[model samples]
Target: MPEAKREAWITGVGIVSTLGEGADAHWQKLSAAQPGADTTTFAPFVVHPLAPLNFDAQIPKKGDQRQMENWQRIGTYAAGLALDSAGVKGKPELLSQMDMIVAAGGGERDLNVDATILNGYTQAANPAAFLNERLMGDLRPTLFLAQLSNLLAGNISIVHGVTGSSRTFMGEEAAGVDAVRIALSRITAGQSDIALVGGAHNGERPEMLMLYEFAGQCLKDKFAPIWERGDKGGFALGSLGAFLVIEARDHAEKRGAKPLARLSAVVADRASRKPGTITETLGKLWDKIKDKVKGGQTAILSGATGSTQATAEERAFLEQHGELAVRATATYLGHGMEPQFAMNVALATVALAHGSLYPPSDQTGLEKPMSGSLDQVVVTGVGHWRGEGMALVERVG
Candidate 1:
């Protein structure tokens, strides 16, 4: 990696998850080691549901809220919170020029329409024609528009008044890594001064659970902390929204914005999942940022999703760095797919700001406590299927 001309600082963070909304609530609840997973509602498959939220707080217009899907609303509310935390909300001068990068999944399925089609298709004399007819007749045109992945960025722009350039990435967990990586790189390379980057996941939908279930990738029957999920480990889906306002250090200083943490280095890779590739990819990413690490003061915030192979491979890599205190955040937040990396990065920033690591939530002895003052954090993100990324977030000044 070439030397950066500027420094990147995380000036603001906004997140809503099973614990609640905002950084303080997350910190307090995570510190207490509480996991908000609900196993019975979805039965067999476990999930961490989003806490009760009044969308009116962040999105005032009922019409605007009505048009967006639950995922879009969750993301828009989080974006508004990030702007608020940065003290730039409603400030037309700044809002008009702030760039945005969002990691998102395709539009949500209209279950009612999908079910109606599925039920009628099997009984029809001509299945293909019947399917096409139902798709054309029963599905509204607006539903197709709503399924567009880029709509999250559009909704955020409409709701938060962010009018700068916008880009959206769509590859599940990998998307979150690249969103932050590109934002940080742009600020460092002088392509942009400030940016809003993150994503959201709504894991409570029956479609999502059914989809993952078909692939045998979801935790079923009971919810255990990530580390103890056993050999056939699977992820417990979680509903969450995470956004971070990262700005060039000088740009923030010029605007009188305070820094929450310094975003030092971000490295991402899509390792072909052939046996040991994930471990090798993670190691290479670690080598890129390992030199900046301070021995005892640095802790790791892992985005391990509790999937069998992925989580185990990440554990192998972590074993090599046993000197650092490690905490697998999925134990509490569960896995939020597209937003998991951003949430872990936000949690790391929150921990760095407080100068301490949150208590470990695992029982396998894989997660250890940190007694010394925290200064730097190395975040690891291994997607449930394909991507691998690592970022170094440190205490600023």
Candidate 2:
């Protein structure tokens, strides 16, 4: 499949996080720099790495949060907004024909919280007492049917009455992109008319942060705020949710939905095990798909995770695929948080649709090639991506 044959488009957007309650608010604050790294205590072990880092959270209005688990609340909240933006209004017909493919990169369940609640509920002898304890916050639902890891997909399917396909995938960060790639394949092959593709995560869980730290995935620095923390933490923890409505060009046009950008290609190669293998892997992916992103309205939407390793990998891709002058926007959208990679891809889809590129955060000091060859958004929230950085990269041959 050469880059010349790939095709897909982004027709909607949605987000819910600390940055803002809805997509527009979230995007506005995300586009600007602020105090994003102030740490907050979630549970005993859970330490929120940054202020806006837990963008998956919302300021529960009045009495809205006590009924749902944290994950369910956030996933449902964000997906609903995304569907609305995509013009999906709980239509039974559209949903039954559409697919729901949601992916995440980390543990979907808050293990620490689960253990605490399950222990309490199991020990209570009186069912009424146990129920009362649960209501009183002492014995939580051990079988919190709402918080199952795959609830994102399940809830989306139920909310929209989607009967086509409902499942979740958990893998490496690159897995988020893989989910979209799979969706594109199904749609292009004429298996479906519309696909609801999204990524999300609630970053407030302690166990999740521990995993990140254990893997040496924490931001490299200790900067404190969105304005000042740019140097300390390579990227602060920030909540993010993104969804895109992808349909065949003809179908989109017939439905009168605005087309943001067409999907070109999303290529992933095994990360090299060696110190410099990332560079080589990136180069290979670029070489394999450069033709797809070449020509009119083409640009690279880098998966800039801010980790030195991730940065190096993407940097190598730019060097080899420099003809189009790549650009990055993650630091602008904030950290992907819990469902790390899924949220990143969701945001990337939006970035592609709007053609707005975000500059790397000041924390990592992602410099424009000293030669200024690659056109990048080096400042905070530069409006819509100027020109078409969203290129239909040539497919891998």
Best by lDDT: 1
Per residue, candidate 2 scores C-alpha lDDT tens digits across 50-135 of 22323233323423344445555566566666666767657676667777777654335646656766677777788568756665
Taking the tens digit of each residue's C-alpha lDDT, what string does model 1 give over 1-397? 7777899999989999998999999999999987768999999889999999989999999999988899999999999999999988998788888999999999789899888899999899999999999988987787688898899999998888999899999999999999999999999999998899998999999999999989899999988998899897799999999999999999999999999999999999999999999999999999898889998999999999999999999999998999999999988888999989999999999999899999888778888988989999999999999899999999987
Alpha-carbon runs more than 4 Å astray in model 1: none
Error of 2 at 73 (Å): 2.1
- Per-candidate alpha-carbon RMSD to the true structure: 1.1, 7.8
Residue 64 of model 1: what lDDT? 92
lDDT of all the models against the reference? 0.92, 0.50
**Model 1: lDDT of residue 326:** 96
**lDDT value, candidate 1, whole model:** 0.92
